[model samples]
Target: MLILKQLILGLLLPAVVGGGIFIFAKSLAWKKESEQKKARLSGWLVAVALSAGYTVGYTGLEGLPPFPPREGVHWLCYLSIIGLISGAFWHSSRWGRLIVQIALSIVIPRLLLNSAFKYTWGQFEGIIWWMCLAVAVFIFWHIVQESFTILPAGGSSPFVYFGLSGGTALVLAVSGSLRLAQHAGILVAIFAASWVITFVRQRSDNNKWQVFPLGASPVVALLLLGIWMNGYFYEEVPAASAILLAIALFLAPVGRIEKIQRLGARRSAIVQICVIALPVVIAIGIAVARSGLFGESSSY
Candidate 1:
């Protein structure tokens, strides 16, 4: 019953709230001035939409966020607000976004992995793990953000993220932690909503360069990394499996390469997604086999 409720809260609630707000924003106008308004608000709006979905899901499943965040999930609620605030810098300038990215990279891993060091590991091991996670966060964010920028932008472009979110959700589920899986699934839902809105609104508009949330990629990337870290620390998820899942999302920008770009959007998208699926599939297989047979996963 809890899992079932998780689906509705994570999937249904976010789709309605986020998608509805975006649609309403479109209903306002298509004039240049109106578009200017959207341009300014678009990235922030994307952050808002994603945060709303995450916040409601967290609160519904876990209850309202408490002061100082006693639980890790509670920290996620606070992180959502942080993501939104930091995401605004994405629109400001590349330098501005990079600074925020660096800051978040340092912060998120420490927040999530502190429990591992405090409760299970020695200070040396903790420092090593924390450094690795922080590096991972910065590297992943830079790769995904830069690649998405180079990739052909269209209504349904950035498809790799949708795949990443769905695949992460699956791995999280099998690795143990229904709540984190659902949260990952909510990411899939939010992107699915974006695809629909982009298709409907972007197709007719002449301004393909309009201000979009593509700049706000860090929020989504860090959010996924955070969820994956939570699974690794709390659920005994295998290190290799977690590693593979993170690598999968980074492959999407390969479609934007000069050789691949010649193939056009449809063909390139197919090739890109195939590249992504390979790691995700292998990760899932490893998680399934080890958990079911070898029982070799590590945990705090």
Candidate 2:
């Protein structure tokens, strides 16, 4: 009975919430009153299934041999639930909507992992890793897309929010665990700066061609600043690189004036950043804690 309760609460909530949202969205798309909107929604759903679903499925399918049955089952459940929520949010371009999606898809899983990390060996893989990879890819693609166009010369796309929130959470964890609060706090502050600058630039629609200071080019400059900081402290390949690349790609393509402006509408800053950062940070924290810092394996 206790096992049943734990299973229902731990696994069922996500499955139901994620599946319910997706089904509801599909239902709305199919309704006659919203056919036009529905059509667009349908197209996005298909695209998401293709893009997000393909990643989830590929990771499971390709990584099957070594994965245990219990682990595989857990991953399938997580992947399906996450994909559903992400697909729902990715369907819209609004910041609020995207934030909700990221909360459901990325934040929940991270919380779960954190909890497990405290209680047990707390290791997880399968869908969690795939979702991280998928979200990272999605953010990178948008960063590159926005860099040449919609973003002002040194401005970043809205994806920096994830860097701020997720990166801060990561710093907090490492700080608490490794007794590196000063260093972690500094990194978190830098991430916040990146988010603020990116948000302002996004709101203003700035697109100048010169490298501004940290605030001037928050997306590119701040991200690089964060990456440099992380690389200095943490030996892990800084997951913040996606945002940094987006910054560089945009700056490099600024010379193609006509090509840059045509990049079209951008995604919200909050959702994209959360999607990109949350999973990677969670994975890194867990992997580091369990595997031991500096690449040494735990005797346990």
Best by TM-score: 1
Clashes of each: 0, 9
Clashes of 2: 9
Worst 10 residues of 1 by lDDT: 206-215
Best prediction by lDDT: 1
Q: Write down the TM-score of every candidate.
A: 0.85, 0.28
Q: What is the lDDT for 45 in model 2?
A: 49
Pairs of residues clashing in candidate 2:
148-260, 149-260, 152-206, 152-207, 153-207, 153-208, 158-269, 162-273, 162-274
Model-by-model lDDT, in order? Answer: 0.72, 0.37
Please estimate how well model 1 matches the true structure, expressed as its whole-model Cα lDDT.
0.72
lDDT tens string, model 2, 1-300?
A: 854643343334323432333334444555747645665565344323222322332232333323332322223324433444444444346586446534443443333344233444324654555376346434543443344343333334323323433444353344332322222232233334333443454456554321121111212222233232233233332334323323333333333345433544233322333344444555455544544556654321
